[model samples]
Target: MHRRHFLLGGAAVMLLPVPAVADAAPRATLYKNPQCSCCEGYADYLRRNGFAVEVKPTNDLAEISRKAGVPEDLEGCHTTFIGRYVIDGHVPIDVVRKLLAEKPAIAGITLPGMPAGSPGMVGDKTEKFVIYAVTKDGKAPSVYATV
Candidate 1:
């Protein structure tokens, strides 16, 4: 009788509905100059990392970056918008994931220039790259991460 009750309990547990896992990957809109191949490569990297990327080729990337609240000194070749945060330049996938998970109250994050070893740029990491966080008020940017 005890064995039968245990088996019944096991069956009941098995029949319980499994909870749905939330999708962590966020959709991104990338704005870049039409002639920049590195921007396309960055988009490809985002796609590979489970992000749905929409590439928008534009003639005025600078204007787009400015409107998106990217600081002048920290602007990259391409700009990406994910959720409510703007990601500038060739930011790594791990950092992007962490930003989404943490949900910090910042305007966005930027990798500044096109580093040699960043996601889109091909080559070895010749030097450390600093990622800056743009404040909500579009004030001075501060170091957010280093890679």
Candidate 2:
């Protein structure tokens, strides 16, 4: 009889709903040109991946990128901030997830030019695209990943 009572208590505990984690996923704020449809597509892609994304349309993307500490040469069509890290261009979602998980000590990561077949950009991916990590001081960028 005691074993039956203990089993019933354990089942009751298991049935309780678990509370949601406050920081389950970081929110992403993306700044893009108002006329760019690809940027919107990227935002949707982020949304599908469990990230809470906020899109801000701007006419001066370059200025925003510069102010965000993205290296000039590594600038992309859109710039985003997730926590303290900047995400540039149409970087693959998997790579972004890895970046968040690793939490590297860098200003941000960039996919450089709008490569075709990237998350938002539409085209055939003829060759491998490289992602660069920009330093906090906005000097040179190093290769962070390739997709």
Q: Give TM-scores for every candidate, taking all chains together and pairing residue i with residue i.
A: 0.81, 0.82
> What lDDT would each prediction earn against the true structure?
0.88, 0.88
Clashing pairs counted in every model: 0, 0
Instruction: List residue ranges in candidate 2 displaced over 4 A.
Output: 1-23
* N/CA/C clash count, model 2: 0
Write down the RMSD of candidate 1 (Cα, Å). Answer: 4.0
Residues 47-147 of candidate 2: C-alpha lDDT, one tens digit per residue:
88888888999998998888777867889989999888989999998889889889998888999888889898898998898999887774678899988
For model 1, name the residue pairs that clash: none
Q: State model 2's lDDT.
A: 0.88
The superposed Cα distance between candidate 2 and the true structure at residue 2, in angstroms, equals 14
TM-score of 2: 0.82
